[model samples]
Target: MPFALYLLGLAVFAMGTSEFMLSGLIPDIASDLRVSVPAAGALTSAFAAGMIVGAPLTAALSMRWPRRRALLAFLVSFLLLHVLGAVTTSFEVLLATRFAGAVANAGFLAVAVATAAAMAPPEAKGRATSILLGGVTLACVAGVPAGAVLGTMWGWRSAFWAVALLSVPAVVAVLRSVPATPAPTGGGGGARREARALRDPRLLMLLVLAALVNGATFCTFTYLAPLATSVGGIAPGWVPGLLVLFGLGSFAGVTAAGRLADTRPRPLLAAGGVALVAGWAVLGAAAGSPVAVAVLVLTQGALSFAVGSTLVSQVLYAATQAPTLAGSFATAAFNVGAAAGPWLGGITIGAGLGYRSPVWVSASLVAAALAVAATAHVTGRGPTSPDASRLQQTLP
Candidate 1:
């Protein structure tokens, strides 16, 4: 809705590019740094580690700073870290920079979600979040592939350099466009007060739902390459196109949630959950059919992101008691899912389960998420439900 939200999305695009593009650069990095591919892969794990730990910690630490100041500080830190990562010759230095850059990125994302919510009307929060997260979808669509191409043509370090260069405009735009809201009111009491918000069952349930939905998404997504090539019989060259298709579907799904999530969160989640379960089951059954897999990938991607993005907004609303830390809760929830999903998928594949096993894993997670949504809806216990106001009053 606001121009500032788009600028925040722009910044997210740069950071998200760095987050995902590393997958494409791992081989080059391992060879250049004289490390094993597995070691280079640890760079991704380091970034995920930063996201999980950094989101809440950085949000609490910066809770008393002016919003715009914290944002700019994080942005500058991200840019500098990318530059450091780009120039580093040692594998350890690059690894450290990746972790630190993720910390900065996590902080910026937490603040950006809060700031985006603050800038929009209460009713438009979902739309604002979708707008912000659109950058991530865009990164998956364009940035990751571009980085891969750059890595192939030039070097892996050039991908890092590109992230640094792209962040410059985002930094400049955020400084110029984002409003400098004063620090949140709680001051030194920030962390304690935010921790209390977690005591609400409604908030906790929403956070768990967020984790489950995203876990399903990443579980299937992380192994899409092997799934396409080995199971669907698609040529390796066509894998990138399939990824783009998934990204496009994700963008569409989030856009739909932007329109409906505020008014119809439960219904949307229920419908999306059911669709995802059926989709994943079909995908698993049809894994050998290239056409079926392609279609399912597009549809499944849409359902995953639509449900995932809705949960993000819902988590923020559920943590209304801790406005400043609401984004942090959301950040931690999704990152936890992101980290666990791929790990579970890896375990399934490593155990001699075919690639289709991850599809079943995704389906199981989505089914669990559906049950959670149904329970919340039936009992009228969801934080955004009409009775939640009365329920909040009953809580200590």
Candidate 2:
């Protein structure tokens, strides 16, 4: 698991950074391409929408291949997509590239957790999963910021070129480093197998939790820049630095969740959920001032995503019988949040609620997520435990 996760982490890092780097590089892109800022914004949104559409489709079709082959294929597609994205000169082409790129990226993530979980020690699955997923948290903290710096000094095209270069190495590393695990797909009737997976209450609960968590986190994240500028009145120069604060906290949470999941996922999930509510509440009240708002957002990002990482791992563990389906569903839940959160936030803002509207709304959703987690605990019929997995193996 050690070297395998490390290799997976490398691919994760490359993909995570490339995906997020576009956000920071938009201004440069807009100017170079002679497009409006919002037009540039479409680049990021296209990627998100692609993930939403591609997750389940990729998982379903790729079921016949072993996990290694599937993962490798996804990464190769990802690398090709980035190359396509890098070569785009017009808006429509860029949008198409991002859409395809995102699908490839999402498919890669769906495979990563399943592959890592298979390699992990029985009780340390959380740690393995976290280490692989940590690339995203790290991207926020390190990759995007560095890419931003690269884009600013050299021009935005350099960012995509850099991503393309990184992908080549990642492909080689995965090919050489990741151990080949037999595909989790099997000999049964695929239709009956899917039906059984659908009936698992534990999986249903996990998807519910994932959607809730993403719904809440993304609600505010979508409007973070404007909210900070309008409500907190932070100057333009300080926005990037403030993002760094949030990224740092995310890194800390990612590291912590890895071990915390192994010790006790439910309690950790509950605690992180509570922290998300409190964190967003603090953000809501503090958005009136620059200093306080930055502090609160940093805290909020760290806690919310920490819980999210744990929640995803929890779902994978719960659906051990159908890891491929579960992994893809995890991505599906994330997009559900991504799509709903911003739509809801936009509605709240358009209602004349002002810049702080998303903060207030997201906070309430986080609070609801906490309530959902608590309800699950009380019911004792929620997300499946490892003990509930259909795959039987003697514990080490």
Candidate 3:
């Protein structure tokens, strides 16, 4: 792997930390801004909405720019947005800044995906994808908790400042490491040219699968804290440790995907999907057992991320014809899931389904994804090789 990939991963770590750490700082933000907690939580939804919109929008606008230029533009935008957010006293201004910051974050992520794939050999795409995603898992383990602590010790504004500071190194990394290749010659007509890939049923299927698989992940993940405390009988103090355990499992899962997804995407997805379904079912059944919940949390996190990362690699591979827009498609798919999962989990919880309801919801979503993967595998549409895809020929 090139050092450039690690640089991209570093950039991702900063952005990922900002994205996830907001959950911990929501109460502080609400209190400081004199808004209700629910209103404050809407900031996260705004970010997710921006992510969904920004990926395709940014990719389209920057279609003709060199990858390095595009990346720096997004990173610098992200850094500035965080600074704006930190200084803003008005809640409305902070909300808008969060959305704008997310747009920049999504833009950089979209470009990073394409850049990482471009840098790696065809046979190593999965490994490259995992390396980039490794930043996210690392953020989950360290950055988020640290940000929460920073917010608690200082103030919510400090976390925003911290994100801005983190982006400084990421900007430097891109400047020093990412190559200044010439602007892309084709796919420059805009999103219309890139949208060509959507016409392919295989690419469409993979996107849907990505959404479903990720939806399952977030459904359970979003509710893990409540489930652990209310049902598993764990102390509230142990919640952070549980989250760290989940992050550790995610790291393990992504590492495994980097090794296997390029060559054996089908088997990996199949096995992972089954494992996730079974694990969620067991967790739901054993919800009252602290030990079982802890064990399952670790295992489920591993399976969810492994399968999710593999699906991302598949989406990138399947959208080969739209090289410039491929990353945006993956980004959009994942954010769609991220948004939907929490909504669905919230719905179930509101309906008196209890905290464990998300476990069942997660299992159902994974089951649906598994069915799609099975259909793709049986119909000869899923990923099968590195140099070639079962669904279509690679771009020349």
Best by lDDT: 3
The weakest ten consecutive residues by lDDT in model 2 span 387-396
lDDT of each residue in 23-99, candidate 1, tens digit only: 67898999999999988999999999999998998998888899999999999999999999989899999999988
Error of 2 at 297 (Å): 2.3
Alpha-carbon deviation at 370 in model 3, angstroms: 0.9
Q: What C-alpha lDDT values do all the predictions have?
A: 0.88, 0.78, 0.89
Number of backbone clashes in candidate 3: 0
RMSD of each: 3.6, 3.1, 2.9
Stretches of candidate 1 off by over 4 Å are 383-396
Pairs that collide, model 3: none
lDDT of 2 at 308: 84
Taking the tens digit of each residue's C-alpha lDDT, what string does model 2 give over 135-176? 877777788888988888887877787877887888888788
Candidate 1, residue 37: lDDT: 98
TM-score, predicted candidate 2 vs. hidden true structure: 0.91
Candidate 2 pairs with clashing backbones: none
